[model samples]
Target chain A: MIKARVTVTLKNGVLDPQGKAIEGALGSLGFEDVGQVRQGKVFDLELDSADPGTAKQQITAMCEKLLANTVIEDYAVELL
Target chain B: MIKARVTVTLKNGVLDPQGKAIEGALGSLGFEDVGQVRQGKVFDLELDSADPGTAKQQITAMCEKLLANTVIEDYAVELL
Candidate 1:
């Protein structure tokens, strides 16, 4: 089996309220050195195929179709 | 400035309803070759510190205190 790790994060210039909340929480906890905090999503996928190429292709298609909002977010896929 | 990327994922034997939903969604979309699907959280943090060690230490503390549950999830921090 081949495993793929996909990270989907908001594109630059996008507003992230969750991230802002985290940053505020960190600040309240006395982590003044902390700067920007952006929250994203990760997907760990197990594929029945051993071929990395095929797995990557399928995972990419999944990301494009459902996993990520391509209009405001970007996704990176890593085959493991 | 130093940046840290933290990934928090469910440990083995833990139930992930979100992942199961994704798996079912994929199967319905004709991606039967896809097997297990685990969903995780990602944090992109920008720190004002230049020292990698200090940034890592603080980020680890952040993970332990607020970022991860630690009871059912494991978190990995990567400095970028």
Candidate 2:
């Protein structure tokens, strides 16, 4: 089996209110040196494929079909 | 400045209904060879520190204090 990680992050111009909230909270909690904070989603997937090439293709298809919102978010897949 | 990524994932045996839902959704979408699917949170942070050691330490502390639910979730920090 091939283990894959998909990280979905907001695109450069997308607004992220959750990230802003976290940044504000961090500052309140005394972590003052923090700069821009962006929050994203991570998916750890186990695929029943031995070939890395096939697995990556399948995972990328999965991302396009369901994992990521392509309108405002970008996704990166890594095989582990 | 140092850039960091913090990933928070449910620990072993922790119930992940969101993951289960995604798995089911994937199966319905025709990606049938999938095994376990775990959903997680990722934070991309920028800290005003040039030193990796101090940045890592600060990030870990942030995880312990806010980013992760220590009782049921674990977090891993990566400097990038």
Candidate 3:
């Protein structure tokens, strides 16, 4: 089997309310120096098949079609 | 001001229920080959002060103290 880790993150200039809320939460936790925050998502996937090339292609398709919001976010993948 | 991106992830061997749920979602989305999944958190922070040394120390302290549940997750920070 093969493993892949994919991360999806909003593009610069996009508003990130979740990240802003967390930033506020951090300040309450005493991280007063934290000026701004943006958040991203991560997915670590283990594949049933072992072929790296095929697994990557399938995973990329998954990200494009379902796992990620391509209009708002960009994705990166790592194989393990 | 300076910026840092901190990613916090569950340690290997820890159960990731959220990732599992997402894995199930992926299967429903037609990713039948996905065998397992794990997830991580990302924080992109802009610091109040510009000094690299101070910003790094503060962010590290925050991660250790509250931003991450250290007992369950490990964290890494990148300067920006």
Q: Give the docking tier of candidate 3.
A: medium
Model 1 chain A worst lDDT run, 10 consecutive residues: A50-59
Residue B52 accuracy (lDDT) in model 1: 98
**Tens digits of per-residue lDDT for model 1 on A24-57?**
9999999999999999999999999978888899
CAPRI accuracy category, model 2 = high
- Give the lowest summed-lDDT range of ten residues in model 1 chain B: B26-35
Error of 3 at B29 (Å): 3.2
TM-score of each: 0.99, 0.98, 0.82
Q: Residue A28: error of model 3 in Å?
A: 4.1
Clashes of each: 0, 0, 0
Q: Rate the local accuracy (lDDT) of all candidates.
A: 0.96, 0.96, 0.87
Off by over 4 Å in 3: A28-32
Ranking by DockQ: 1, 2, 3
Model 2 TM-score is 0.98
Worst 10 residues of 3 chain A by lDDT: A29-38
Residue pairs in candidate 3 whose N, alpha carbon or C atoms collide under 3 angstroms = none
lDDT of each residue in A1-80, candidate 2, tens digit only:
99999999999989999999999999999999899999999999999998999999999999999999999999999999
Q: Local error of candidate 2 at B39, Å? A: 0.2
Question: Global lDDT for candidate 2?
Answer: 0.96
DockQ of each: 0.95, 0.92, 0.69
